[model samples]
Target chain A: MIIQDEDQLTAAVLAETERAGDPRVREIVRALVRHLHDFAREVRLTEKEFDASLDIVTRLGRLTTPSHNEVRLMAGSLGLSTLVSLMNNGTEDSPTSANLLGPFWRQGSPRMDNGESIVRSPTEGPPLFFTGRIVDTEGNAVAGAEVDVWHASPAGLYENQDPEQAEWNLRGKFFSDAEGVFAFRSIKPSGYPIPTDGPVGDLLAALKRHPFRPAHLHALIYKPGYKTIASQLYSHDDPILETDAQFGVVQRLIGTYERHENEPAPDPDVTEPWYSLEFTFVVEPGEAWLPTPPVSAQRSH
Target chain B: MIIQDEDQLTAAVLAETERAGDPRVREIVRALVRHLHDFAREVRLTEKEFDASLDIVTRLGRLTTPSHNEVRLMAGSLGLSTLVSLMNNGTEDSPTSANLLGPFWRQGSPRMDNGESIVRSPTEGPPLFFTGRIVDTEGNAVAGAEVDVWHASPAGLYENQDPEQAEWNLRGKFFSDAEGVFAFRSIKPSGYPIPTDGPVGDLLAALKRHPFRPAHLHALIYKPGYKTIASQLYSHDDPILETDAQFGVVQRLIGTYERHENEPAPDPDVTEPWYSLEFTFVVEPGEAWLPTPPVSAQRSH
Candidate 1:
């Protein structure tokens, strides 16, 4: 059909929803058509330019890989990741603020006992003693909640992506004990730059934007019969907290790093002074919680 | 802005385009808005579904790569490649029909003298002799036109991707002699399957579409003071000629392969007697034609 006007074209596309075989696809396509059309209109796109934009998008698809999430990076850079996360996690009343699962989560992380250190190196950075509890919305402890945690090292590389780090270094899964408590010894995460070598970097450069993400620790908490919480605890003082490329910063998700100064401890294990953070995860109760598909499941087109 | 209805959203977006800083960006954005908004209205998209669609597109951006042009494959499957090619090529009449340059063009092909065989395999397939000439619109020889040609092996794999074939096998660059005549010995090109291991494949599977491209040889003709042409010559009898996955089929691009029957003076040097194809390219007079930046240029996004 010759789509002369925007209205006619939109109406035609929306009408396809009724004939769409998959309801999910139909709804998704309709919305996509709207937003895409809206974005174009908002930008007053020309034919040649629209074609060029399509070319850009096409190139993006061709550049994807297991280690590189250019598509996800684009989404995150455009604030779409935050938008999706917000839409999915609408129970904003919950204590923990959700964030985008920034492209580095992998399966098969070794499980660790309570209070086990996730950091493979004891002297990597300022020692951080992190303690957290899993609780229901009503403030009652929820035992057996599994918490998955991971972070980049001082050099700003994930264990999986860095060959120098052993397998699953600085990454571990901890199950909350009877008291619904979990603790792990690790270094404070340093501020780092996102992978800026791909299309996302090109986009950021085009927009005259920076690619730094604020210092933060990644966390995913899950419990039976309760909504799983995917969140990050950002350092309160990190400069990028306000302008995170992924739009992932939330006030509720910020945690304070307390530096314990000059407290003489007799334990030889506590070599030097350290910083600590104590936080609690309050999950919403419900069986209707939306399940997050594993990264691999979502990796395919 | 609260985009309650499609019209208001379109208007809002169009107004925003007026404020766009870059004229090119403004024109492109306007067209994009119109097409995207029209598509949305045509589909009657809902907010919830729109959000999900946004997520999927974002993920697609994260998945881009140099070796894998998944986004291009997706766009091609959706007929976007043909549309872009048509728009770029304009309405000029020409001797050969243009087609999408499928993602396998490699650089630094070995230059061959006229009449040299592009086929390196002695036992690969039936030997075919291809003769071609470059001429102007008035049918006069246009010497010095460089013909770049490459094709898949009998097993339907490009030399670069296949380990068995030596580098630059079944691929060569030959400059037309002073008479504008060029010929090469090669096996008859065979139909090949597009890569089906990525999101592009997933999209095709979702659409219940086959991923076979008809047997064809890719060619790029370059000459000073004339329009450079990038095209493919398809075998007339290929079954998938009508329904190419990328919608790249054009009637004028099909070439007839004539079987050379038993001639008493069998050329012993040419083992496995096969067909012959002779075609000529007519160039349109112009300044040195500049080809579009290759698909790789936009891949870093």
Candidate 2:
């Protein structure tokens, strides 16, 4: 067909997608074409700008590897990841407990009993004892769910990114107990910068925005009868709680870390000024599955 | 600020752009974020799908190199390239002479005088004599413009892609005469399949779409007073004219290839079954600049 104008050209592409046998794919692709064409027209994007944008997209892809995912980072930085998470997991009234799994997640971390610390290496920081409850949307305990947890060290690097840290240094997994409780010990994670060495850094610099994701812990909860969720629980005390670089922060997912100086620590060897965080996760009933780890390989040999 | 919902998340991303110093970039980025979020919402994009998309993006980058650009290819497949081209050039009424530069255009081919041939090596196929005029929107001649011409051989492989072909074979540069006329000779290009061993190939398979672009001659016309248009004069008789894999076929840019069986050839040694094409390019007045060649390497040592 002769594509007479931009609208006609868009329609042609959409028409091609209809030939696909998969209805779901066809629908998603058709909607994508409309929005993409609409976006180009809305901005009156120039040839130079279009070429430059292609370069950016190429670099985002080229910069990604097993140890890092620049494409996913850019998605989070744009808030698309969070928006998708919200739309998929919960209703308008309840909001979603789901959040970005982020680029640091890996598959098959060591599993430990409840209350066992995931802090496997000599990591330095004030100790953080974390407790969490897993429940359904109706507030009933969701026991027996496997919860995989990982977080960045206070130095702003994951075990895969920091060579000094052991393999899976601040990473572990546990199952929710009969009461739907899971606990672990680790140092208080501090607000730190994201990797600014790639195209995403260029974008943040252009937007004049900081690359700090407020201190947060990542969790992926899995149970057969309920939906599995990849989540990040932001620390309420972090100053950038509202401006997380990934935009993964949700109001209800924020955990308040109580600072304690006089009370005895959870681990007898821990010093004063320790902290503790208590939070809960609400999963809905649906298909339960696991995500492929965005960065599966650790840097350690 | 705590981002409460999808709408709020979109707003927060838009809000961050106000900090950008370049209002044009700020505007474009804001629009991009909105459309991206809206696309996600319109499709109710799932976390698994989103993750899969990111994986697609990463492979698009990892597969790109100096000789190949999977990212740009995917954009062309999506029709964003043509949409951007039409949106930036001419009027909604006049349409655009500008088109995709495509992945095979290179930076410095040897320049030649008018009526010369660009077939620098042994190539198979009937001879093709291409003549074109450069004119402004008012139909006035545009003289002294440098025109770069290139096309694939009869075997449907560009010089850069086929190891047996010499560097810059079927590629030449010519300048418009006082009458705005420029012509070059090469083999009649056959429609060719795009490289399909990447994510774009995956997309095409999923869409049940073919990977062939209509046989076309590429031209880049540059003059100081008018816009530098990157164009492809698609063969009107090509089987896939209406279904170009890149979605780059423009209505007015299609050129008729006159076939001669008994007439004298343009060149003495050329056979009876040669083809000839004459077309006029209408350039709109605008800022002039060249594009970075999407692919800039030769496969041969």
Candidate 3:
């Protein structure tokens, strides 16, 4: 084809990819090309602006590391992750919901006994005793399910991000008992801003948007017959619940955090102010699968 | 507003940017967000596919360095650069056309005298004597204009990509004389593939698309009281002209390469078979502006 104009150019490019064997991939590429052309036209993107955009995208990739996934953060900040998660999971009004699997998730978290604390490192804060039950869509408990839980420290940094924290601080995996109940202990988390030294930060600054995510505990539930659910439970009292930077806070995922003053710890070994949260997760019927973690632990091997 | 669904989430993200003081930024961002969300919905982008896309983008950025710009390459491969350039320049059907300001442009190219060769190092190919005139759309010569010209070597590598070549081989800035004429001598370039070790290569491989760009010479013309035009003149007889990897080959930009056998050289330098190309660039009326060069020469001072 003689590619003289944008339309012809687009058609030529699309035609070149018409032989893509994978139907899904072909569909995606076609749609992507069409939308991208439309975007350039709709905005009349200037050459300078286009150059800047290219630099921004390149910087985003360059800033990402094994410990930090800047691309994922950008996607979440742009609401793409949230949108995709909601669309692929249950409908907006359904019970079986999913959430963004943020970049902090690490595979092979140390397996712990139920009711044990995920806080492996010493920390000072009000303790959070969390309990959750995994159930099927029919309201029946799915016993023997595996629940992986993780959260940030009181300083609002994940263990991987904090040098003072232990290797697996506030991360653990446990099997649900016969009653489909799982419990864990960790310090109550506080909202923290996404890393602002990278491209995502620059974008947030340009958009006049806050980078703080609401305090939350992450969980990944897995069972043999039901789809795995990757979710987070937002604190009911979190000040940033209304404005999570990732827009991950959903009504059904909000959990009430009951505060007690100078109450005995759940393990009865010490006395301190503490908080407790309870929530239930509903898993839908589908092929059981686990998503690849956004970030991985640095290997010393 | 609570962001429970894609529409709501998009709105929330867009609303957060409502206070951007720059109207252009706001407009571009709004259109971007809308199109991105629409693309996702239109394709029903799966979570896995989304993750792969993010990784590809990240890899593209990571692969880019001071020596290379893979993100820019990806943009060109997708035809976004060509579309934006065409849209922002003279009408698609007009003569004052623009082309992709590819990533190889280096700032501060050494200025050369009129009718001088840009080849600074030893090179092996039939010598190409290129002459061009810079004029306005009204057919008036744009005297005293600066024309920056560059091209790849016969081996399909830019001077920067090849250590054997001098720092500024096949790159020079020449001022158009009173008659709006400028000339340079260099080796004839050949079509070459873009870097194939990056994510763009993987994408092209998957789409069954070739990554070869037709042989071409690039020129950036600047004059007072005229808009800067970034353009490329393709070899008229190059087999790949119709399928330029960057989709940057336009009909008006293709130049005929005439071969002279044992004829007197344009310059009384040597007796050898040579090629000559003549092209005319049409500049439009606008503020003179220079784009940020995609790549910069490393400074030693």
Candidate 4:
């Protein structure tokens, strides 16, 4: 298999994959080599560009830490995460509520009673009383499901990514009641710029693209009989909802943030402009499990 | 720009590239996104598999250093390096004598006179006397060109990778004579395994592929009026030449390692057997420049 040109190079690389023991590995690797070679051929990629890409990839790995997963961030920024999520989840007719479980998920979220506040530490923002009703494709209630919820604070930093925030300040795990309803009180989450200190940031600046993700609250629901659904409910009014940096937005995932002014606040201490968000989560029947947390440690000062 | 499915995901991502201030960046990045999303869809890449890939990508960066370039190695292993080299080097007919400047290449090789051994320290193996003639497409001699030569010792480690070896062992820069000829003396290099303590190792193992590259000598020739050609001259008899791990071997680059017996050796320390290699390097007229070094620091004991 002496390679004489680009085609021969591609063929030779594909030929070697025939020796793989696993059929799935063979299939995936063959496709990868084909697409990878095709990319080089399509762009007629130069050695100089190839070299620079290697540096960027190297930087991706070097910059990743327990608090920041640069590799995953780059994938989301490229839209592969959303593509994979859409392709793998849901039926052909009914899309699954499944979405990307971004790098911010942390495990061991403290269990809280429905309607209790997940705000473990003092924080300032308009209050949000969010309610979710878990249902099946038939619109039947799926009760007793464990729903894990978390979101960024008003300052646009996850508890794990900001040291000033107390542990699990905006994170909680709530179990649905007999009516398949779960609710929690927290601050209204808003769009924020992704961390720009890494390679992905360089890419955003290079593309003249903003790094803002539309405001969203993340939830991971688990039950034994049904598939686990990891989803994000985007704020419909966020300016960048149409241009989410992570490409996590989907039409069905957008939740309305109904504003109420001069209305009775859920807590008497709360002032005006509090909000309410209600959405239904649909889960399919399949294997159910938890995802390994992507980010774990809090940022150090 | 709402991404409802995989195709929409791809379209949205590509559309964003339109905003890139640099046209070249837009083109390359758009093609990359299309191909990347296509790969995920073609494989229906699972969330678990996608997550695993991020870990692998992260390791590629974390393992890379001034001395070890795992990201580049992964690219070469996948044959992207060779495909790009073949594409940008020469026209369709007369293939350019260009090859991949593998991560092993370093800058500032010491200058040496014609026929001087690059073996700056004691090493084991059969001695080799190599000569290279520089020529244009018309077979005319190209004079006053500089030829940089380097190769691994029989132990399969470059000087920069082995602290036991003296400074710049098996590396030298030589000026071509007025006759367009440059010759050097060194050990007959042999095939060796690529470094396998990282992601590439996992890939090779997963594919049941061998990691050895055929024995070859590397040369980077530079002249003001000609394109700099980075090349690898393969031993015709090397078993793995047909299955190079880096996909670096080309038909024209294989050189016959003529053997001698009971003849006077080039050195006064006579030996019964020595090898000689003679090949002509053809460089087309174009810009000439040196590449940045990929590896530098020596391995610490």
Candidate 5:
């Protein structure tokens, strides 16, 4: 029916949306309209404020490109990404910890041997040897699982964001060994700021919030029978872990990184400090799916 | 503080935002976060749905430019613009009946003398003679008030949207005569559909809602001591008045436009079928201000 008042207007919008071809789409639109209308009323949003919001949101879209996903960044900054991941993955109280997909993940990372380095350039900082295992809830090893790993360079820049780094400098894919183990090497990542030259930066500054995410390694594990888990392993000792700007860190996902100095390198080729990281992923029974990466490595200049 | 859970994360985000220099900005951000979190929880939003929302909202921004405002159009399509306008203006139960400041309202309309026509082109349609008065709460005429009038031509296109129409055709500015009266002549406006090639149009189709707004004349009044009102007068007999896509028509704002056949024109020069629209605007007490036009007429082709 045609709406004649504010309340009726909202209802009509929702009612008409019920005819959507997809049931899920219908449900989502209904919720969005209801929540949005309630928000306007709850705040008595003024015209000026509404206009300001439209301007900021529009800028967010304009700033986004194949190499930049401002929408994803905003979602993470607002905690919605974390909330959605947590809610869908496991029970809120004790689900396997998951983190943001972030804007740096790329599709079709080059497959590498178990001990090969994902590092393709002469990067600075301590060498990091990372190892992990994927298993079902029963603790049995899930052999032949695809593990996609990526992280920033020591200087806090992703390969895509830094012109000095080689293509896919710190990105690689590995297959778990028979015992459900996967291992790779790279330079340890350091805490770094999100891109702040755009609208998100303005919001962070205005909110007085630091734009830094704690140093962490990203892993997307996939197996035919287990639910794919897009996860991050945070450096437990990093100063910003507890205050990650993306709100992506969970206590369960933080792991200790053992450091060794002046010791023989694991490969016996390096004469510098090195670190090792290890963790295990608990998978549930479901269809394995991969998230669309927020940004791709190849960007137009 | 370091966040350990969803609640803690939300609290930390809000805490960090308290540093905003402007209190109003702080309040708005706080409300925005709370409502956003609540909406996610209410819907148990999934990652796929979240991604879809990001795509649609991003398109809204990308589709916008200096001459076109897809964001404003979306806001109106959702009935948000009308809601905000009404809530901010007169009381909910008895508002002075404000409407949307649609994208077609160009600033600095050509000034015209009382009883002159806003029409500058050889347009073909029933001649429309419009008149209105501005009064205060005490019902006293508001002399010297400025009235800005604009409307689309019978072909359902504004001057900017149609090259056939001269620059500023069907747009004019006039001052209230000593008796608080203003008048002009132009072709009667026809009901029109909003631009449907963008995201807002996609939404209208998905929601199973029409995009047509009833034929109406826009007016922006300005007086030194009274609040400037941006309003629209809807044709009482228009079929779509009860179902304006923008939800902008109020019961009190609808008025009858009397049609005459071969009658003596209100202005002695006219000898054709014509229509006359008469209405009174009640200005509330407040500072006079003009809203920033959402889009400009001079666009880069």
Candidate 6:
């Protein structure tokens, strides 16, 4: 058979389900065939163009890595990442909104005591004390919650991407104290452009869109019996927050960084001028915590 | 924006093209947006599912190598390889039909004189004599054309995958003599299954399809000022020829192998009876000849 028309060919491929031994396999194949056929029809796809698209996808697979998540980058730039975050965290009354975990997030950050500074580079940006509480929907504090926090330095480079920085500079793991209070000092993160050098960059350039992501701090909060929240706290004043390249901006996740000077505080070892931000994350009760495979896990594999 | 509808969101993405500096970039992005949007809509895709798909693609990139064309394998199984071949070599009238250069075919095979056998392993299978001529469109001999051929062993494994086989067993590069005639002895290839232990296999399994390709020998014929023909000669009797998993079989490329036994003029070196196949290929004029990249090239950076 020449397999001329794509629709007919797709239907033929799908029709094999009638003779399939596994029902689940048949169902998945049928759905895949339908979607593939529908896509071709909707786009009025030509054989040549369809083939070119496939070639590009094949190139994407060939270009992926632990440091370079080209496929995830493609998915993020295409709005698929945002769509996923919305669908998976659609609880109406959830304390916090979730977002893309991004392709960074290295493992084994220094675990520090509450109130300890995670910032190893004091000169990179303004010192900031981040204080937050993990609580339930009813406003009850949830102590002993683990908070995984990480962010790019003021120069817009993650420790993993910068040879000058230590292994986990400005990255740390902390637990909420007995009163559900968590405090960590770190340098303020600055807005940075997503890497635009690979195929993903080519895609963004082709789309004529900017690749800048607003300054934000990444947080993954975990408390027993409460849905873990994987989210970003965006600086309210950052311009890209309004037009995030990945469409990940949520109104509730925006906050302000307040500047404080000459405050006589607990430790004189602290820098004279510093900034601070106080926020609380409310958790919802659910079993839908889909933990991302740690960066180490993928590397180990 | 929440981006509830995939089509509308895709339209928004494509609209960014108005700001593109290059017209070609704008045009390509437009087409990509349409196809990608159509794919999502056709699948009634949820955000979470799309994210999962991105994860799969990201992993694919990290698993590539020069020797392993995992991305190409994925594309071939998805019917994209055929599409790409069609795009690059439009349906112009050519003496020989083109097929996908599957994920094998390494560089640097031993060059053989005309009529010399290519099979290094005598115990591999029943020996078969293969003869072919390289001719131009008018049927005149195109002497000095190089023909590269390789196939799986009788037990059905390529040299790259089977460690037991010598480096280039059943593989050779030959030059056509002054008469455009070339011949080699090798075992008849048997129908075999594609590798089914990876994601491609997962896709095939989900589609409720077997990953069998019909018995065939891969050939790359090249001469100056002519289009290189990357093709497969399929056995006419193979059961899966009609439904090759990669959709690569063509009627014109199928050949018949005839059994010859008890000939009085048998050569002293030959002990067992064998089969024989004689076929000729016609070439078309083109620019500098370049053989199609092996499927491995698709995965190699």
Chain B fold agreement for model 3, TM-score: 0.90
Q: RMSD of candidate 2 to the true fold?
A: 2.6
Candidate 1 error regions (>4 Å): A1-7, A14-17, A264-271, A286-301, B1-301
Chain B only, TM-score of each candidate: 0.87, 0.94, 0.90, 0.94, 0.91, 0.85
DockQ for all models: 0.08, 0.73, 0.62, 0.79, 0.56, 0.20
Model 5, stretches more than 4 Å misplaced? A1-9, A12-21, A261-265, A269-272, A291-295, A299-301, B1-9, B261-263, B268-273, B293-295, B299-301
Q: Please write out the lDDT profile of model 6 over residues B161-236, one tens digit for every residue.
A: 6767777888899999898888887888887887776677777776567888898898888888877777788887
For candidate 1, write residues B1-301 as lDDT tens digits: 2111223435543543454456665565456546655555456544345545544554554455556666666566555455445444424443334456676666666799877788665437877888888777777888988888989888988876776777678889988988889888788999888878766566556544578888999887888777666778888888988556665665566789988767421245754457888887656665554345454423122
Sorting all predicted structures by TM-score, with the top scorer first, yields 4, 5, 2, 3, 6, 1
Query: What value does the lDDT take at residue B117 in candidate 4?
Result: 90
Per-residue C-alpha lDDT of model 2 across residues B51-93, encoded as one tens digit per residue: 8898888888888888778888899999988888888888887
The model with the greatest DockQ is 4
Tell me the tens digit of each residue's lDDT in model 5 across B1-301: 4546665667766766767887777887788788888888888888787888889878988989877788888887777887787778777554564667787777888889988888899888888888898887667888999899988888888888888888988899999987899988887888898888888888778766788889989999988888888888888878987557677777678868999987898877778888998899888888898866645666222
Q: What is the C-alpha RMSD of each candidate to the true structure, in Å?
A: 9.8, 2.6, 3.2, 2.0, 2.5, 6.5
Clashes of 5: 0
Model 3 misplaced stretches (Cα beyond 4 Å)? A92-95, A117-122, A163-169, A185-187, A259-274, A290-301, B93-95, B106-122, B163-169, B185-187, B260-274, B290-301
Estimate the TM-score of every prediction: 0.57, 0.93, 0.90, 0.95, 0.93, 0.71
Q: Candidate 5 falls in which docking quality class?
A: medium
Q: Return the lDDT, model 3, position A276.
A: 89
DockQ of 4: 0.79
- Can you write out model 3's per-residue Cα lDDT over A112-174, one digit (the tens) per residue? 998888777798788888888887777788888888888888898788878888888889999
lDDT of 5 by residue, A87-115 (tens): 77766565764677776778889999998
Per-residue lDDT of candidate 3, residues B1-301 (tens digit): 3565665778887876787777888898888888899999999898888988988998999988876778878888888888888888877556585677776777888999987889889988888998898888778888999888989899888888788888888999999998889998887888899888988888788887788999989898888788888889899989988767777888888899999987998877757899998899888888887766544445322
Query: Using alpha carbons, what is the TM-score of model 1?
Result: 0.57
Q: Tens-digit lDDT track for model 1 on A196-235?
A: 8766776666544578888889887777787676778888
